[model samples]
Target: MPPRPSTKKPNSNPLKKKGPENKFQRQQQPQQHSKEEETPFDNPTNTIPLSLQQLLLNVFQSALVPNTSTSQDGKQDASQRDAIEDEGQLDVKPLIQTIKSHLYNRDFDSAFTDANEELLRAYALRWSASRTLGYAGVFKAVLGILSGDKERRGAGGQIVCIGGGAGAEIVALAGVWRDIVALPTDDMNGEEGEGEGEGRMELKVTAVDIADWSGVIRRLDGAIRSSKVSGSKRHPAPLLPDGKRDKFSVTFQKADVLSLPEGELKSLYGQGTVMVTLMFTLNELFSTSMAKATAFLLRTTDVVEPGTLLLVVDSPGSYSSLSLGKSEEKVERKYPMKFLLDHTLLSVAEGKWEKVLSQDSRWWRRDAARLRYEVGEGAGLEDMRFQVHLYKRL
Candidate 1:
């Protein structure tokens, strides 16, 4: 006989203990995937174009199921002994849930297994695509203003994304650069053609995370480059001032941001128009250890030069717990994310960061109904509501 339904109350902390099993679990049966409807690439919209989203899906699909081949004697090796599986048969919900559980439990190391890396990365990309676009929007807005400032011009500088190894930051920054170059010369403050190479405003992105997300970032880089070559014909690759293909380079560095020394961190920051991003990342650090987080901010300030920009995007809500006084007389308090960031970064004794932009809440949505890949039946992607804070080092 089939198992009966569970009657226990849902656990507030999913990581604490296992929840009751759902006997009537919904399964995502294999179904035909649909393609995204084409849309103009240069529409000046904050969201990712449908065609580009489709490209992401295509790249993910190819990675999920590569062409299989037999050995020399038509025999399979131990690795290939297991039968290959198609995308449809790949149960993504459990993998996603596992990742969520690991993250909730602060077990980041467990989330980086080879078996689940692709799925983990895919889930993150799908879950935060809108947030990524939102980041791009904020960057574009701020850079447009900074472009006019002679001292803060960051035309050919690097963008360092702490905890952005999922490659969202890379995609967003690439989009921003594309939009910038597509503009007329007069709008770019005439700094476009003065970079390392003539007419080449090279963008270097480094995605740093504790997890070994090198494979994921590598795949994403390939996909972005591939899209430029074979994507929508209407939107041919944008050209540099020298009439050459625009250059956007990205690399993945696996490291713990909180543990990096000042000199190493400075080297990573590089020079000229440097920007650092902490999308859905800062809160995690605070949650882990307020002391460590505070040290990280102080260390960052000491490393990065003045005029560097720091952009942080995270879920809009108060989810931080702070402890005050000694252990016996300790008092715990819950603080809002923005307040924590402000209190830490703004209240620093030396090298205080100037608050450039702060928004309590901002909504971002994307229409993923037409996507070629489905996460699972009844597992549609939800829109994001986040808070954004931008700062400039003094």
Candidate 2:
């Protein structure tokens, strides 16, 4: 709704400024000035150190400056870009772009073939995390669920992160629960006497992915270890929350989400509410192949029951396989808004999901991240952008 105009009459007391004619308004007019625009080359956010930002910016120049190399299939081979060699020093932007081309194409074989696992790990740590996003606002948003609602606080559920590369968000999810579990009684919901004992099931954050990136398992191990105690609803009450001896805490599963195993799905969604996060997965998948992408979404829909929480974060370009120019052999597909959500929730698809929050932002300023991206005219040849859809099964 548009805001209602203010009803107050201007300066009936004659002390307030009403318009340009007012003394106060005239006094302030001279102080107003036009602001200069900033760019990566000149004025930057400087959230990232200037030296590192320059290096990162340089990588962009080195990668996109030319027509670039072609793969065996005659398409742009982002992976084979000149990132290493003569100086024995690495220019990571080129390498990241290459891996991304393969990754965005969903070609894991070429993406990981002879790839320096450690370097890729380093790239995720230093580049993807910083360049893409830094804020854990989403985690806090999720955690707020358990904080505000008394019914939800006692029903700790499983957090399953699909396509959890490097497990960055997975770690953040666990961290939120960790702090939640470590909270004092008053901090948590319920009357003054209510405690952890009030909750029957302990919260679990699981990282599901095809590739187990470096530091993922260890980092998850630490995060999970901090979320458990003895008897309080944990199965068999393991010594730690790592879920090592038994299934008690965080789990890292190496499996393709397109056809997830039924046994694992049942275990996760069998008795309690299950929270699923699809972070940039649909974008990458749909960009490469639409049929496979639909199949994957269907598979996820098949598993979820009513009351399941799903958070989908993707790009419209990927969601629709956006092509800038006309293609000779094929045409790009344009999906309707919330296409994924509608399919997953429609009666024909089995799961009936309810839209909780759906927002599309353009040139949105990502909190704490220096970069900004917009679709259409505002976007560059390459820009990191996002659109979000939050849902819950009916």
In order, the Cα lDDT scores of the candidates are 0.55, 0.44
TM-scores of all candidate predictions against the true structure: 0.70, 0.54
Root-mean-square deviation of candidate 1 = 14.3
Give each prediction's root-mean-square deviation over alpha carbons.
14.3, 16.9
lDDT of 1 at 51: 47
For candidate 2, what is the lDDT?
0.44
Cα error, candidate 2, residue 179 (Å): 4.4
* Candidate 1 C-alpha lDDT tens digits along 143-208: 454444545443566778998876667766665555554332222232334332223355678889
Question: What lDDT tens digits, residue by residue, belong to model 2 across residues 20-83?
Answer: 1322332232221123422211111222222222222222222222123232223444543342
lDDT of 2 at 169: 61
